[model samples]
Target: MDASSATAGRTGRATDAASRRRPLIDLADRRALLACRPDDAEVTEAGRRLKEAALLDFGIKESVVAAWLYAKCHYQIPTTAVETAAVVAGGDGTCLLLYNPGFFTEIGLGGVRFVLFHEARHLIHRHLYAEPELRADPVFTLAAEVAINHVATQRLGQGLPTREVPDGRGGVTTERVGIDPREIHRSYRADLREQGLEPLGYDDFVLTDLTIYGELRRMRNPPVPPPQLCVHLAPDGEGPALDDETVGRVVEDALTETMRAALRSGGLARDEMLGLADRSESGGERLGRMWGRLGLAALRGETQKTRRVEWWKRWLSDTLASKLREGERLVYPKKQGAVLLALGHEPMLSRRGPERTKVVVVALDTSGSMPDRVVDWLTTLVGRTDGVESHWLSFDGAVMPFVPGERVAGGGGTNFGHVVDYVEGRLEVDGKRFEETADAVIMVTDGYAPAVTPQRPDRWIWLITDGGDDWPERHDPPMACHRVTTGDS
Candidate 1:
C-alpha cells in the first residue's frame, strides 16, 4: 500500500478507537454527574435574589421573562462529553439545562445568568426546530452563536465570561468563552482592508437569524469554529430529538409569557418581545397565529408588520374579546346596603358581571372547496375555549345543523344568506328553534355567493376562503371579515 493509504488506515482505526473510548452515559455515570452538579440551593438562592432585586428595582419585561424561562428549564448533569452547558429537549414539553458544575464555578453568577438567559432565548427563537438548511451549515451555527451571545451581552450589559475554554489543541486555556462574532469581524476587516467592504455594525450584524447568516456568508472565508464551540450546536448542530407536540407546548408557554410581559411592561421588554414575534418563521404558521390569538395589536410602541395567520382568525379573536369582555350581570343588593351602613359615607351600589357562556354559531361552508384542516382547527379552537357553547352549521346552498364525524352532502352553489336568516330567527332548520341569541356568529365560506346583511352586524365574522371573492372588503358597510388559510397558502 502507498504511504497515504497506510496513513488513512491508521487514522480510521484511531477514530474508531476514540469513538469506542468515549463512555455513553447511563445510571452508573448519573451519580458522578450529580456529584459535579452545581449546588442546587446556592443556584436557587442566587436566582431568588436576582428575581427579588429585579422586582424591587426598575424591573423590565425581558428580565421578568428571563426569570420565568430559567424557572421552566429543568437542570440536569452535563454529561462527560459536554464541555460547559447546553439546552436540550427534556422530552416532556420543556427544555433541559445540563451544566458542568466546575464550569459554573469558573463563570460565577454573572455567567450562570448569561448561560441561563441564553438558553431561554433559544426557546423563544424556537431553535430546536431551526431551519434544516441552516442547521446543516457550520456558518449558520456560528451565526446563531453570534446572534444569541450579542443579545445576551447587550441586554444583560455584560461581556462574555473570561474563563477556561477549549484551545482545540486537546488542552484547556484560560480565556474568554467560545468563538465570538466581534473577533471574527475584526479578522474580516483586516482581510478585506482597502477592498471597500464595510463591516456592518454589531447590532446590525445580529439583527435577525437570517441577517447574521446572510452577512457572514459574504465573507471570503467565514470563521467556522471547532466542533466543541457550542454544546447545543456541537456534533453538526442537528435539532433536538423531540416530537412536534412536545416542542409546541414549550414554545407556546414561552411566547405566551413574552406577550404578557410586553403588555404589562413596555420599553426594552416590549422591544425584545416585538423582536421575537417579528423574527418567528412561518412554515406551519403557529408563531404568527399565536401572536394573533394573543391580540398583539394591544401592544403599543413599534408595530410588527404583516401576519402569516388567517385574517379572519385575528378579527374573530379581537371581536370575540370585545363582545365577551362584559358578561352576565348579577346584582348584589345586600352587600351594597351593608357597605353604606358600615361607613358614614353613602355608597352607590353596582352589580357585578360574572362571565357567562358565550353562545357562538360556527357555520362551515362544506362546499366543493372547504378545507378539512381549517374546519378541524376551527372546531378544536372553539371546543377548547372556556364558557363557550358552539352551534355547528354546515351549508352549501341550504343550511343544516351538522354534527362532527357525520357526512354532509354539498353540490349546488353557495348561499351565505341562509346563515344570516337562521341567526336572525327568520328561519328554522329540522324543527330546531333559532331563538337562542348568539353572542357571536362565525361563517367560514368560499364567498362565491351574494352577501346578505346580518341582524347583528357587529357580532358577525366572515372568513372567506382562498380564491374566494372577499365581498365583505368591498361591501358598503363592512362587517368583521377575513380570509382563512388551509396551511396551503
Candidate 2:
C-alpha cells in the first residue's frame, strides 16, 4: 500500500477495534448483563461493535448503552433470531443488510443505512430521556423519517418518487410516494437492530406513535386550545372568588409528573420545564392546603361552620332573631358583637360603626405596572364595606375621581406627584358633601413613581408589588405609610 492508503487502513482498523471493544449491554456491570452469554464469539464481537457505535453516535454513555443492549440480547433477540449484518470497507462506507429470512427479501445495506440514519436523528433529538412515558415514541419515528428522507436525497441521489397511482378508474389517479410510510418506520427498527438496541414492542410503538402522531396531528388538527384555566376559590377566603393562582398551581402539578417522566427517558433536561412552582404564596388557602397543596379541595366543616354563622348574622338575624327571647337569638352585629358572639357571648351590636360617620379614601394606581391580583383584591375589599362612605380614585398623569358604583379599571403610566397634587387640589375645609374627609388614604402600587407628601394628613397604607421600574424614596414618606407585600395584605 502507498503511504496515504496505509494511513487510511490503519485509521479504519482503529475505528473498528474501538467499536468492538465497547460493551453493548452496559447494565452497570450489573448481574443482568453478566448473565447473558453470547451465542458464540462472533455474536459477542458483533454485539460489542454495534453497542459502541450506537452509544458514541447517539451520545449516550456506555453504561446506559449496555443496560439497553443487555435487555435486548438476553431477553428479546433470542426469540427473534435473524439479525442485521454489515460490511465495512473503511472510508465511512458500511453496507447494512436487513432480512428476517422467512417472510421478507433480504434488504441491502442501503435500506439499513437509511433506517439507521433516521433513528440517529431521534437520538440527536433526545426524546427518549423522559420517564413514566411522558414523551410520545412516534415523535422519534416521525423525526427519523423526515431526516432519513433528506439524507437519502442528499447522499444517494435517490429522491423518494411521488408516483401517481391508479385510483380504481382509468381516468383518475392518486399521488403517493414510492417508499411506504411503514418502511420509513422500519428504518428506525433496523437502525436499532444494527446497534444492538431492542426495546419492547409496545414501547417502540408508543415512542413511534408519539413522534408520528405529533407531526401528522399537527398537519391535520387546528392548534391545541390554549391551556384551559379553570379558576377555583381558595379555601380560606384569602384569594379572589376566582383566581389565576389556583389555576397556576394546578398547571404546576400536572407538569411535575411530566418533568419526572422526561428525566427517565434518556436525553431530556430538567430546566426546559417552566412555571412548576408558585411565584409567591398569593392564592390558594391561607394555610396553603387548597388542592391538597397541589392546588385543588374544600374543607367541609370549616366552610360550613363559617357560612352558618355569617348566614344568621348577616342574612337571617332580622327575621329570625326578633321573635326569639333576648338570650335565645344568635344575633351577632357590629365589630365588638361579632368578636364577643363568636366567643359564645349573647349576640349584640357593639361592632357597628362609630357614633360618628367614617370616611375612607382609596388612592389606587391605575398604572400599567399594577398586577391583576392587586386590582382584583382592592376591588373586592372596597366592595365589602357597608356603612362607611368610600372614595376610589386612580391616577397616572392626573387623578381621576372614581365614585362608588363607577367602574375604574387599571392601566396607565404612573405619576405619583400629580396624583398627590390632585388630591391636594380637590380637598378643602368645605369639600364635596361628606360626613368626614377621608380618615384613611390607602394607596396600592408596585412603588413605581416619584415620591411625594400627601396633602391630606390622613393615615396612609401602601400596597407594594413585585417587579416595577421605580420606587418611592424613603425620605419622602406619605402620611403614616404602612406597607403590604401581597394581595392577602
Q: Identify the leading candidate in terms of lDDT.
A: 1
- Superposed by TM-score, candidate 1 places the C-alpha of residue 45 at a distance from the truth, in angstroms, of 9.6
What tens-digit string does per-residue lDDT give for candidate 2 at 44-95?
4444444335434322321222122222222222101122211111122211
Q: Candidates' TM-scores? A: 0.50, 0.26
In candidate 2 the C-alpha lDDT for residue 59 amounts to 27
Residue 86: error of model 1 in Å? 1.8
Q: Residue 429 deviation, candidate 1, in Å?
A: 40
Worst 10 residues of 1 by lDDT: 1-10
Model 1, 1-489: lDDT tens digits are 000000001111211112333233422233554554333444434434443343233234335556655555555444333345555564456555554434454555676666666666666555434556656677776777777787777777888766543456987566676556688667666645546678777667666777777778878887767654555564642333433455456666655665654554356657766666554443236555566566566563333454233334434454555554354422224575456536642222232356646677888887857767667766755654545677888888888887666776776777888888887788888876588888778888877888787767777777877667777756767776665655454
